[model samples]
Target: MNTEAEVREEMGYSESNSHRLFSVEEYYTSYGKIPKLCKFLGNNIIILWLIVKANKDMHQLVYQKMDCPELLQEAVELLKETSGVGEDVSATIHDSKIKLNEICRVIKEVYEVVAKGICMLGKLCMHERFLSLKV
Candidate 1:
């Protein structure tokens, strides 16, 4: 079994970085640790909300490239694994379930948005072609 300090070290959490606040991008780039970070923040409302806000800021720059379903699935898996629910029934199953459901809802919304974007892009392309033929 790994100690807490070892886990923190593996996750790129160090005393130096711990003393200073960092933006999401800076934290991610500095650590290069996504799964570990997600597990560390598992189901914490404030942290999750901050993550959502950061994601919204990043979405404008990378919306087309984002794979929401995969990301949500991975998050669920990480939360489950880290929450100790799988290893012991004493873990808070209800909380984990709630968080999982929330992630699924977000996944559904993401798919809906992606589908709408595809439809709009198709319409725009068709309109452009139609206008070109008349000229």
Candidate 2:
């Protein structure tokens, strides 16, 4: 897997260089650990757009919160090992409030099939995680 610095060096750009202008595709394809993880997690355009629009510091904070790089690799490996079966599934998740830990557990345990179904049914193109908010 390419780290942010490697990708930046390959593309001849980095967050440190603000003078150069680049397309959204080029920008997201080249920088940041979170952007790299987002690409691996399905590469949804809206999510990428959100990431590009979000504050850079917030993304750094998320990386700190999630213990990134490590979490990123684990997520990619987990997704790879449990390739989606594309089964048909439907349900209403009713709750007064959903905790982040519970959401994380569901994501780790059960959302795989549901996400596959959503993609298979064309209801959603893909699943995306934007961790710009404080975790």
Candidate 3:
């Protein structure tokens, strides 16, 4: 499992970079952790997409969230694993996740799959963190 901090550090990425995960308002706010977590989770999903692309067997069973066609379950799972806030974020990310049984044959489709996953997760990140806000 990749910890958010570990992933960021190993990638030579700091919060200050242009791709800085969040704005100043977010960094200091109570709900900020969710956005940062989403970035890490989404990055990991993108990495997983690459890994899945290279492998044959593993690509067949790409886990996706229910309902939404473009979203991947991995991003939600990543947040659950890394942030300790499972339910709310997953609910937000898993709006539409369609299954792809044969990823290799449709190799070119991986980019779109990944792009949709990224977009869904971005939407999730932008949503107000209900759990953190409650806390």
Candidate 4:
């Protein structure tokens, strides 16, 4: 597995915005409310893009890529492992799936905007670079 730092570095220079990962600790520190943390992180398009970018490199070449259903299942497993909780927590997580859906929706929409912005900037930069090339 690629280390988190490696992933972060690869993702950092891909766009103008500085991508920050949302840890549970950082979430509590910034928002203090676990319920709203996902929503907050969702709106940060750069970071959301980073999350998607991190997975971009995987499930290629030697193996089939994980589809969305597989990804969701993996995420649930990760949550169970990280939380170290049993059925009660599982029940809570089940109920909170709506939160996950909302966050995913926000992330997708924000990312589309960021992607368009980046493409526009890239075109401008390319034009600038070409003009400079002749100087």
Ranking by TM-score: 1, 4, 2, 3
- Runs of candidate 2 exceeding 4 Å displacement: 1-25, 28-32, 35-97, 108-110, 122-135
Model 3 alpha-carbon drift over 4 Å, by segment: 1-105, 128-131
What TM-score, computed on C-alpha atoms, does each candidate reach? 0.29, 0.23, 0.21, 0.28
User: Across residues 13-112, which tens digit of lDDT does each residue of candidate 4 receive?
Assistant: 2222223333333221233332243343444444455556776666342333445675566555455444443433454466556466555555455445
User: Across residues 1-135, which tens digit of lDDT does each residue of candidate 1 receive?
Assistant: 445465467566675554332434444324345445556656334455566689768866322322457446545544544443333433324355546555555555544455445544544566566668779
- For model 2, residues 72-129, the per-residue Cα lDDT tens digits are 6655655653553211111113455656765555554455554444333331111123
In terms of TM-score, the best-performing candidate is: 1
Error of 2 at 3 (Å): 24
Model 1, total clashes: 0
Poorest 10 consecutive residues of model 3 by lDDT?
A: 21-30
- Per-residue lDDT, model 1, residue 72, is 62
Error of 1 at 76 (Å): 31
lDDT of 2 at 76: 62
lDDT of 4: 0.46
- lDDT per model vs. reference: 0.50, 0.44, 0.47, 0.46
